[model samples]
Target chain A: MKHYNIYVTSKPVIYDPAGRASENTLAKLGFSGIERLRIGKFIEMQCADDVSLESIKQMCDQLLANPVLEDFRIEIVD
Target chain B: MSDFRFGIVVFPGTNCEQDVAHAVRWLGHQAEYIWHQDTTVSQFDALVLPGGSSYGNYLRPGALAAASPIIAAISEYAAQGKPVLGISNGFQILTEAGLLPGALQQNASLTHICETLDFYVEKTVCQWLQLASGTMISLPVSHGFGSYYADAATLIQMESNGQIVLRDTQARIAAVCNEQGNVFGMMPHPERACEVLAANHPAGAGGTVFSTIVKHLEVVR
Candidate 1:
């Protein structure tokens, strides 16, 4: 069995409203000079050892993340 | 009277199918429910993906529903140049399935907003809008994620293709269609706005767009 971790974030062109709201809360909590903040998703899954990176990429493109508004990075768990 | 038949696609988490069917019947049209597991949508004169949080909207508003079997059927239905309307969450599903351009993101305020909004018609090429440019229509918009987002390049292409059909006072995209103009997706709920006599008109502005699409299909088919 293999473990995979996927990180999904909104593309720079897409606005992060949730992230901005969080930043505002942080500022009110006295955290100053915070340049930027973003909110993203992290997903983990178990796959057979035979699954290739290309197959995982296809999954990401097909359903894991929307390519139009979000970008994703995948990591293999050792 | 043109008796058009509409199919309201229903996923497990859908709550608007009954309302949509009622609205269709009110417009003197026939309507039936099409489950997400079903594979065909060709039997109806037109298809409507109604408002609701399909699949609980946990994995993104329309992410799970877009991969359902019926969406594939919808893709084929649209390819044949038939009319398809997606309202509220349906609009998110359409973008997820690649039926329409742009993605519906979280609102700029990062909060859920449920209220009636004024929508302005921009281009008439969608035809189902049946309204001239500069016309305003009021409909109920209810959603937590209703911001329309597209890369600058895609926006330029959509502009060139004449796919933008409607916008709000703030100039946010209220509705859009496919390049071929056969499908439309919007974040407003027309069904919720239908038949409000208290609002002065019996059918209301939302009903106008809803009935217009069915009537338009009736004329062509």
Candidate 2:
């Protein structure tokens, strides 16, 4: 079995409301110097060794992320 | 000349199916619930995807439910230019399924908004909307991720095609239709406003939506 990591984030052009709100809260808590923060999701999965990167890309395109407002990247860990 | 039948697609965690069904029935049409696992939606004259946290809204709101088996049938139904209405979370599912352009992001306020809001009707091309253009109707919006976003080109095209149907008081998009004008998605719970139990009723503006669907079906049939 192989381990894979999936990262999904909103497209840069799309506003991340939750991220913005979190940044404001951080600022209130005296956490400064942080220029920007964008929120996203990370998923770890185990796939059979025979699974191709192409299949993983298909999974990202079809289910893992929405291409319209979000982008996703897949990495094979092991 | 038979009565128009509406199939309300029900996904796991969907709580608004009954509301939608009741609204459809209130409009004098036949309404039925279609499970998410169903493979065929050919029998219904029109379809409605009701609001709720489908698939627990995991990963993203409406993302998982958009990949369910029933969506394929709904897509096929939309291809035939049949009316398909999606409300609140349902709107998210349509965008996730590519049945509609654009995506719904979290509200700018970063809070779950649950209030009766007035939506300005921007266009009447969609099969589900019959009010005169520019009319404002009251509907309840209850969602955290109801902010609508699309690429510039898509937004421009939607505007030119009269697919942008309704906007909130702030001018933010509250509802939109596909270029074909058959598939409609909105963030408001129109179903909730389709009752006359209150004096200052929204006059069941949402019920008018169902009636419009029936009228369109009658014309096309």
Candidate 3:
């Protein structure tokens, strides 16, 4: 079996309401030093030796995530 | 009641037919799976197009499914004012079918997103939405092309005409209704959240979609 790592993040301009709300709360508390806030996810999966990277990429493309709101990366390790 | 037959359209790559059907049955309504080859939607109260890569997302998410044999029938049904709903990729198919207006663009980030989104109900005329207040309902959304795109004029018209439903507080539209208001298309899955039997569905409250649709069917009956 092979191991893969996936990292996903939202696009920069899409407006992260969650992050913005957190920032607003922090600013209200006088914690204005936080310049940038972002949220994302990381996923790791193991695949059979015969599974190709292209197929794994397609899986990520089709159902694993929605390409509009999240970006993902796959890293294969020996 | 007895005549309230609902058809769940099946296209190549569609993966949510069973989920939709189970939701329909849970409400004590009749549900059938129809092949993409059927040229006409048979006697039915409503139709549902569930999410998946119909035609392997070829051409466009639903552009090919729109040309499927059963689409003509779906068009006829929509013309007659029967209710129709497309969820996720199903939403794409409706846009491609012209059953609903506005196309689902690639997500703003152009990434595959899977998470429970905070969907606000802007209208109750649609069967899938049950909340009356301006409350945010959290439901899982899994799609690569769920962003909605249309010219500003059309968006304004839809809003003014009450054809837009479920807009986030920031006015980002999450769902839309046809002019006659019988058809609705959204990116979230009420079916997947309908019951606890499915591991992922446990405790998900999106079942209001099925109950509301069944209520509408009762009225039609």
Candidate 4:
């Protein structure tokens, strides 16, 4: 069995309104030097060893994330 | 001419199917509710993906529901050059399903907006919006994620192809149609504004939208 960790986030060119709002709130709360913040989703999945990374990429492309406005990264976990 | 039969798709967490059905019936068309699990959607002449947080907006607003089996049928219906309209969260689903080009992100203000707003019609190629290109109409918008985003190339292409159908006074796009002009996605609830209310005169501007679709269907037939 293999476990994969996925992180999905809005593309950099696309505005992150939620993240900006949170950044504003943090700045107001006296958090200094917070350069940037981008809100995203984290998904963990466990599958059989035979499940290829190509298949996982297909899943992300077709269902897990929208490529038009978001990007995703996958990492295999030990 | 026979009345067009409209199918309102109902996802697990959708809340606006009934409103859409009411609007269709009020507009003198037949209305039916199609469940998300149903595999067949070829029966209806038109399809509507109404507003609401489908799948409780988990993962993304419409991500899960976009993958539902019914979407394939909806795709087939759209491929047949029939009209398919998605309102608000339904718009999100269409974008997520690749039926529409842009993605609806969180509103720029990061606030849930629920108010009646004016949308300037920008394109008339789509049968759903048959009004003059510059006409402004009132429609209610209710959603947290209503901002539209697309890459520069896609936006440029949409502009050149006249795919952008509606925008607010501030020039923020509110609705768009696909290349074939059969699939449409908008972040406004036209269904809520279809009633002739005494409080707001000329309040039912949305009725024109539904009527226009029916007339277009009839003409095509």
lDDT of 3 by residue, A1-78 (tens): 989887766666455655767777889998868998876667788879999999989877654544544567788875
Off-target runs (Cα >4 Å) in candidate 3 are: A1-78, B1-3, B127-133, B200-204
Q: Assess each prediction's global lDDT (C-alpha) against the native.
A: 0.85, 0.88, 0.77, 0.88
Per-residue alpha-carbon lDDT of candidate 4 for residues B96-190, written as tens digits (9 for 90 to 100):
99999988888888789988888899865777885547788988889999988888899999998889989998999999999888898989888
Docking category of candidate 2: high
Local accuracy of candidate 2 as per-residue lDDT tens digits, B36-155: 999999999999999999988998899999989988889988999988999999999999999999999888888899888888988657888854477888888899999999989989
Lowest summed-lDDT stretch of 10 residues in model 1 chain B? B196-205
Which pairs clash in the backbone of model 2?
none
- Stretches off by above 4 angstroms in model 4 are B197-202
Interface RMSD score of each model: 0.9, 0.9, 9.5, 1.1
Each candidate: chain B TM-score: 0.94, 0.95, 0.91, 0.96
Candidate 1 reaches a DockQ of 0.89
TM-score of each: 0.95, 0.95, 0.70, 0.95
The collision pairs in model 1 are none
